[model samples]
Target: MTRGLSRRALLGGTVGGLALTTALTGPAATTATAATAATAATKTAGAGSRRGAVGPEPYVPVAVGAGGGPAGTDRVHVLKIGPDTAHTVLVLVPGMFGAAGDFRLLARDLVAAVPGVQVWAFDRREENLADRTGFATPDPAGYYLDGHYRSQDPTAAAYTAGWGLARTLDDLDTVVRMAACGGRRRVVLGGHSWGATTAMTYAAWDFDGRPGYRDLAALVVVDGGVRGAFKGTGQPVSDSPEQVRERLAAIDGGAVFDMTLSGVGLGSRAESTQIWYQLAGWYAHHDPAGRSVLQPRLPDALRPSSPLTNAGLLGTLVDVGFGWPNDISVHSGHLADADADGVRGWVDTGITPMSRVAAAYAGGPQPAVWEWYWPSRLSVDLDVADPYVDTDLARSLGLRLWHAEALDTPLYAFQTSYAKGTIVSGARDVVTNSRIPYGTYETDNGMTHLDPLFADTPHNTLTRTLAPFLTALR
Candidate 1:
């Protein structure tokens, strides 16, 4: 797996910059070509034409979830871009509250980078849109309930990791079939946060009826969306939001602490809001546009929550084992470098976890499935030997419900010292200390939670330091 922004101006410089922008409004041949190329590029590249910075709009939703029978809570919207009949398809899974819109810049770059290829993004069914629309939830427990077949409740009943894992793999399998119907042969499964886990899980784990698990060309796990910390390795724990919170019980940290407290494993919607607000504010200092990117996703109900407060965000992160406390400062461990100052501040904050990440990186032939965002509870455990449901389907479905250790096998554990290839990345600002899951024991300092999605970011350094590693896929 290969893991993987901008700045503002001086107050006085903005006026001059605006005047320059206004004066250059002439549509000459160069501008015309740029526009033409951009348009052609979008059609060739699969850029969504959505408003704002997220490139062109998304492809007409061809089918909801692969074979088209909706598999998720959110209809899996799939869009295919490109005319190449026999091409490699990149299946993208977005993070929580993330939509196809999140891949704007990355899709454009990928289209331009890899010729004869298509990129597809899906909206998984995990979230309940009804809360926003004032409609009642279709399934009150929403698929992750304790007694449900997908639930990771062994003591409560029995384990079902397999159920949850199967759900994700099957979703991808459906998408793969739908995309394959159009004739794409090779597939690159890519995901961020929870999406990444789905992508990787599908990669390594075999789908019940799906054929050609061997046909997978690559896997991109962004941050440990699964069973462990940011790196993703370590025994999986079914730590509740409060339990995780308690682990990092200490506060009194600075900006880093504040960042973690504001954004990590907050159980309720209220906690997430507070952390996001702080992030929106902190990120605002660098970009003139501020964190408007958050406005679209951050619920209006959370407008009152203050995210900048240090304790809540950082404290929450520590407890969840996501954003780590600085080994040196022991205060906080999250930062962004979309802008010059942000980058500088990040560089100065403390030792980059990547730089000091000590791990043994050797592994074996590896499981085909690669789970990026590991589940916290045993939701549906496939690997476990339990009596919840005798059939395999029941356990497979459970993998989706809880965070389990087995899910992060290939990516986090050193069980694959002999394997020739692996795909992994973690975001720097991940609320989940997800990096561990990315490497069996080896750490890619270049990776951060979002690095795989943001080409310019540090996490997906493979795109930068080892372009051939990816481009060769062509």
Candidate 2:
């Protein structure tokens, strides 16, 4: 999965000098009015307010997999922002290896812009003690174990079995219902990168002969539409089926894929860290107040002006798959814009020395100081099947998740010109194969994959793109 800064300094000198921010124009004002009216009617119809008149609502951890029995280990955290009387909630899921914290900026922007619409960032249950410590495999420090499912050893099992595709879909189903607050609200489902895949899959899933996400009003996909990557053609997405099979085996076998530096033979956490620290440092130098915006989510030591030799902070990034080499990069078949000069400049600067990186690793903890960052087990499974499911000789190309007859939800895609293939192919497949009305919006801001989560301007692009679509929903 692919995964942005300041109020003035941040927005002023964006990468391409494009002002993605939009003023509250005629259409936007109309959309806000419609949203306000919709929420007012909900209040009149007798839905109690969950948020009292106050500051931003605090995030409430909702026990997901455990149902209503006991406080379960598998929990989905929800942060609600806006008028409590609102009946429409946009539930946004984070991309793989990304937590709910990633969507904080986007959620805040949406609530401030839309009059009555509330935004809930759904943090899927992911932390697995087993996977983080490398207990799932013989090698305790293997970076390949970064995104696998948790183990079910009776001695080590925290709650239930590790998650898979079926379970992830079920989890989203649970989150959707929870967001609905007893069916009083209409839910909009959206996600970025691999999170987009989860959203699309949930939209197409069949639950007891009905659409699993029956409450969903719309789908928003950002920079990812690979669910239908192989649609409408019998051609193999890879050059050869053998290649697909080989890659699948490697992914399942815990082979790490180096994505940071181009052709540098850097394939492990230590090697990658030496490069990432330089980037983080460089990014910090260029953006003065970026640390203020990022401090809430990023580790303290990684913040700008910190001593450049903080091994512990760098180690955390490796454990979470940011700099650490993992199978996900290879599995997704996209380097997530690491090839860009913005990403590569850190390594090109040659500031992070191998000696320092080695000393940092050696001085670090024995078990690699495992951070509580584990992706859904089912996500890894999907990576293995992406080649076949995204495309197929017999099914032509596209997703094999659900029958087209079952899809009737409205779909919207926000794509970049760089990855036009994903958006175009996915939209084509959804419209041609299903009854879902689809639309596509694009930007040429020349941002890397993770910019939307970090940049304020891109959110402006999102606002302009979604105004008409949301107004129509009213």
Candidate 3:
């Protein structure tokens, strides 16, 4: 258990912070309240209206940066949701291999539920390099199939050699400052998975002698936080300066920056696994009941024993009991139409529905829900900057986490069943070490790593918890 404002206190506006003192006042407060009430009313009425009033406008993508690196890879893209005039803003960062559109549904829900708040979902600089031509075509599946069969590899953008945490943090700081509006608005920074780790690291980051926490009102970490490499699967944590140097040297020596899904073999050919995942999502959304085009191509070891529909194929690729690596597993569910049909379908047993997952994957413009070119260098840098311990490796990599002990911002951490209890334990460590006056730690053992973002609204534990916290901050 952790100590903080109760949901009731938070929602009832009984909690106070420095934010309350700086909140909108007089006529400005009245206008904002009216706009929010109207927006809420529209949402409520739209629920029952057959015509279904259009929800908030589509997220507007805005590019921000000083234009650095190869072809300006330093530029970060933000999908802005809700009215810009809203005084309170929440900036969300996606996890490893995730993009701005990953938070599409969550951002809409938050904007609707919280008055005078907007969500800025950001795609890291690497997203600029993703190839969206296949997704943009009338025949996305066909387009992707052609590329897959040809074994097309993603471009090895060597400029990514410098795209480490330092560069990432710098890019994030640019966005944070833009959203903050020179201290006129309260900004809450949050992220999921690796993005969550980035959020905490950002709060503790040293920006030219100014501590990172001072720029924000609070923090939110969903299913991710600082931990040693020993505590997690996939990447190995660097324990020494030599190990860090070795990893950096590998990147400098033409190592690819993009990540591939584990357990799937595209034979000996070099192909883009990120594109394969996106193709799965495209088919799942557009032809759920249709026969899968990608399944027959998969190796026998990884393919389903029986023929499956596109949705079922996608479920097998991402669902938890299918033996796909945990890093890519998004839900827990079984196959359907097993006995009565020519092709099997998917049945979601987890909090998130398959349809929602499909939309998250397939429904955005460029830089959709997937980050095709995730920098390996960022992972290496995070390993060296483990918040719980300081090592000589951190200095060698130019990583700084010196402010966790002095951080004063309130933190809210929510964990899923995926990481057992380690996620919440990490949050506890942050609060304890920093002596943070307010912090909340929650666990929903029923949900998977990605469920918090895709789970249905109203019943979503993340939205329910996060809305109240953001409200209290105001």
Candidate 4:
């Protein structure tokens, strides 16, 4: 089932039964200075762990320009993981609404598993616009309360009207070039989910008459792709020119960013959906066992029969078998005490641990995992570009997928249970369409979409598979 660009499909519907009638007040807010201090402290503490070899420092933030656009609007942020001395660099692009921090755990494991390798997780230009005020405080409640009551939803940046795939590709090219270091090092480009589509799109993209695959030694796709036999809940293949034009016009009319969830009333309010996700994440990470303030606010259908802990609340929202659709569940199991009449807690029945999921959302030295101001224009362009099918309409929209038959890069793709065989089939399509000489595809039907990245196992499928693939390139 190739998914359309409906907001519900994109966001997996709203967190069940979230209805906020009033915003609760928080303690005195911390300043940006506090955020910087917190970040420095986090860097010193070093939250991520490496197994065999000493990896690169975590959360090293780097900024580069997309080559053109408004002065500050073109800036792209990257979180560097692994040692700088490593000669092999894997540039990882995040999925939609995802940030560099989404790859935090996976990057650490990859660097340790594969010697002489580093990972540079890419964050889109929009990440620069997120307000870090809530992240400045160490207290989870403080973070939650601040975002809930005080967060501001600024008007969408006018420049964002033009932040489509063309500009995004330009920004990615800059990062790839920097990581390549004038051909001194080997570079592999990879992405997860929508980012996987992005990597595939980039491989076939035309940059000033040059094919994008020439810049990379290999390609890696994690749980997403553009073409497949299954067509199960992935990106749409195309959009009508008239529809594209209407979307563009809407962007030009100041609807440049997506700030609301489609179905929920509270989420429809400016900034509420973003704030709720962040707060829930922080609460799950910092105070998993603590009583949740958010639970009482949820409608009975979504809320536990009894009070829930912070972790339980998050689990209820995201775990499979909790009445949520399987596509939206990041993990395989529900929280412990979920059915009990008292406070709920966590159980380790899933590939991704609740703590790790929380950390991804809670964030660290880098920006939060979720993008608060996802550019609406990128979706419009991606609908036309993701399939790697070139057309006159695509050319008109500056979406260049003209080099599908010319791509020569080796590909390795892994699929989680959420996508089943779709991702691997998509990889096959790329190899077949391009007549590419080399490709590898694997599927872990036991894991969720996020399991490859956040699974708390020593034998992570993604890590083991990707480590060997990248090491072979050496």
Candidate 5:
């Protein structure tokens, strides 16, 4: 079952209900922050045990270093795979609020399919738990009271300010250099979702004519390297510094967009399942009134009834992260056992964040299942905080304002013609405006945003698609 949702439904609203009140409290809104986070959570409890959703092999940590902050306390982590004899390397970046584990399918397949070619993934300093409505401090354990993001140094540092796009690019540069091993290793930079944006930002950054990390290889954007500037609900926002500042300010203070409405953040597992069931009714059964099928009541004290409307769920589920590209949800065995089994499991529909909560409620909270997958905890501070309008990084990245001279590197992008999102359109604009040596601007048929990431077999669809293009890289 494949379905296409209207762009309006997909780009819901920016501020969630709880986020509004928190942003109103100003920067010193720590007290309100906790309540807001609690509200964002479908269920809650005391601290749970630390566990990994993915196993401890193939994906090995290559380097561990300190992340930049006032305290320099946050930890930076990088993982890699491929034979040492390999000359070419592909470095992948995860999307916003996405962890390194999400790329397990792509990384594993790349190593097996491509001979002597290495694949690497990094857990960005930005991939941290929200600290009182901001990033800079990582609270992976405290976020769910379970130590999921093990790379986070709990005692490392405290939040001083936002980690801007420049720092994020620097982190990517460091990872690239590490992967190169002090020598000029042929490297291709690619990213999924927001990571694609990060990769594009890295490619666009002016390296001052130095060829350390900026040597010619190729820029691979998988579904998200677009300069989605000034995209808002109801109307397109103007690309103005004042507008950007106001947007970031709202998020920094504490603005939460309803996940259901925003078509971004995920509700609890129960909520997700409710969302899935509702989607199944519409796409599977073709019900015109499928919008109100399976509305699940949640445990959040204030907004107990899930804000997830049938209209929003219908669109969000078709997205790569939230649901399968194909609208149908398969009964893929017991998904909750993945954490204990140490196996990568596909998160089927009907398993929302509340699934863990329900299990925890019935029994003790089971170990964090599906290490490979995590629900998005949309942070006003980290995820959508930076409205990239007229910022220095935005200019360097060729985001809002394109710089043709700055973008002289080779660029290749795979965008589905059915894409109603910013990535494809943005890529086209960037290619048109910049001096990017056009490589492959291929459009795939019937592939959803995540089809390139979550291909499940050894003969992976994504790796196979990129093989010919990557092989021809000079």
Candidate 6:
């Protein structure tokens, strides 16, 4: 039976976890960071893991560190692959707490179906959860958890254990250079969710002269939002941290919805899973209503999906660090302002922060299935209190910001008709914000956060689709 795709929401705001790392030596480190991640059993947890969903014989690849850099620059791992020949080399980047395996279909499809292209999904920087355990110290780097940002100056050093954006981009630069087949085979640089944000950031960084960050046929962004300065409003906020909390208390029916990496101190990976579990539960419950409209673009197969193993999840969230303005639930004002020309937008949405109590009832399944393999107590910092309040790291990451950068929408408008670049977006995605024609600056074929991956779902379609796009690049 051809099972229909499930209706899983994107990461559903559940941040696996993250912090910061310093081992970003060079392009080799970038290459090494994501190169040797342990590849899991494909059939166990892959793109087709959704219930009743059946199709390809679960594509997997065994990727070992073939050769690159000096003798022992980094280690190598393997991936599971079915039967196919790859002509194009794909460097798949995952968002916070994400792994190389995350890009199952994109990699599989492009490698298998997309003729003459070898797509290799990568496990980007600082995802290693080997060192620290049981809390971070209360230092400047420790207490500076801002809003959950996929692509921004990473401030969650103490919050989790992820790599810095600059390092990740740099690592990617070298990985592509080292593992790349050179001009013989074209390369496609792509990121999923925060991974896409990293892609855009890396693109900008490359344009800014980041070493090893170069030469790509095209960029593929799977269901990601643009972050920067706001466009319309330029006013500063009036509320303090306390004021922000109070604002949430006064929300209609005492409800607060937040999907930030903020406030997650030292707890079990359960808390990490709890975050998304609850959020996904919320989305699944609220899907009938128009409130959770942002997630409709997810592949139908993913909607009914179960929680993924929390193995390297924390490593993912720590990279971005926890902290955010209350914008996910309420109409946010963060990205409300943008010049589009200069990459600034308006922050009009008015989101609210969450209370300790609210998150409990709202969270979804806190799976303990992989406790044996992934471990339970990933990290903890009960000692590190907020500068203002003596709460946990969650509260520490939770600081209400007054100003944020809006994105420059039309900035990329010049890419099209000139460079073979076409924009991919879901109409329902709030990241598109209030475009005049509503997401038509480039090739806004109505894509959302999850649209970047789900080829066919609602207003979520990618004109540049992965396979052919990377194939043509060569």
Candidate 6: lDDT over CA atoms?
0.29
Tens-digit per-residue lDDT, 171-227, candidate 6: 566556644556555555666544554554444343243322245555555533233
Q: List model 3 lDDT by residue over 344-386, tens digit each.
A: 5666556566666766677554648877666668878766666
Please give the lDDT score for candidate 4. 0.67
**Model 4 per-residue lDDT tens digits across residues 384-441:** 7656788898889888888888888889999877655777887898898885779988
Error at 213, model 6, angstroms: 5.3
Number of clashes recorded per candidate: 122, 11, 0, 4, 17, 105
C-alpha lDDT of all candidate models, in order: 0.33, 0.43, 0.67, 0.67, 0.42, 0.29
> Which of the predicted structures, 5 or 6, would earn the higher lDDT when compared with the native?
5
Please give the distance, in angstroms, between residue 161's alpha carbon in candidate 1 and its true position after superposition.
Answer: 13
TM-score of each: 0.44, 0.56, 0.81, 0.83, 0.55, 0.39
**What tens-digit string does per-residue lDDT give for candidate 1 at 1-474?**
211100111112223323332333333213223223223323322222231122333444332333222233324455444444537776677643344534534554556555666677664433212122101223222221222322112222111112244544565666777766545476766665446555545544544433333445655544433333223322233234454333223211111011212222222322232223223322222221222333234334222132211221221221112222221012213322223222111111221121111000000001001112222221223222121112443333333322222232223211111111122223221213322233322334433333333333232333342234346666
Identify the runs in model 5 with alpha carbons over 4 angstroms from their true place.
1-73, 128-160, 207-213, 227-239, 251-406, 421-425, 458-461
Worst 10 residues of 3 by lDDT: 1-10
TM-score result, candidate 4: 0.83
RMSD score of candidate 4 (Å): 7.7
TM accuracy, model 6: 0.39
The TM-score of predicted model 3 comes to 0.81
How many times do residue backbones clash in model 2?
11
User: What are the candidates' C-alpha RMSDs?
Assistant: 16.2, 15.2, 13.5, 7.7, 13.9, 20.3
State residue 424's C-alpha deviation in candidate 4, in Å.
1.8
RMSD of 2: 15.2
Which parts of model 3 have CA positions greater than 4 angstroms off?
A: 1-68, 148-156, 227-236, 256-263, 266-271, 338-341, 388-391
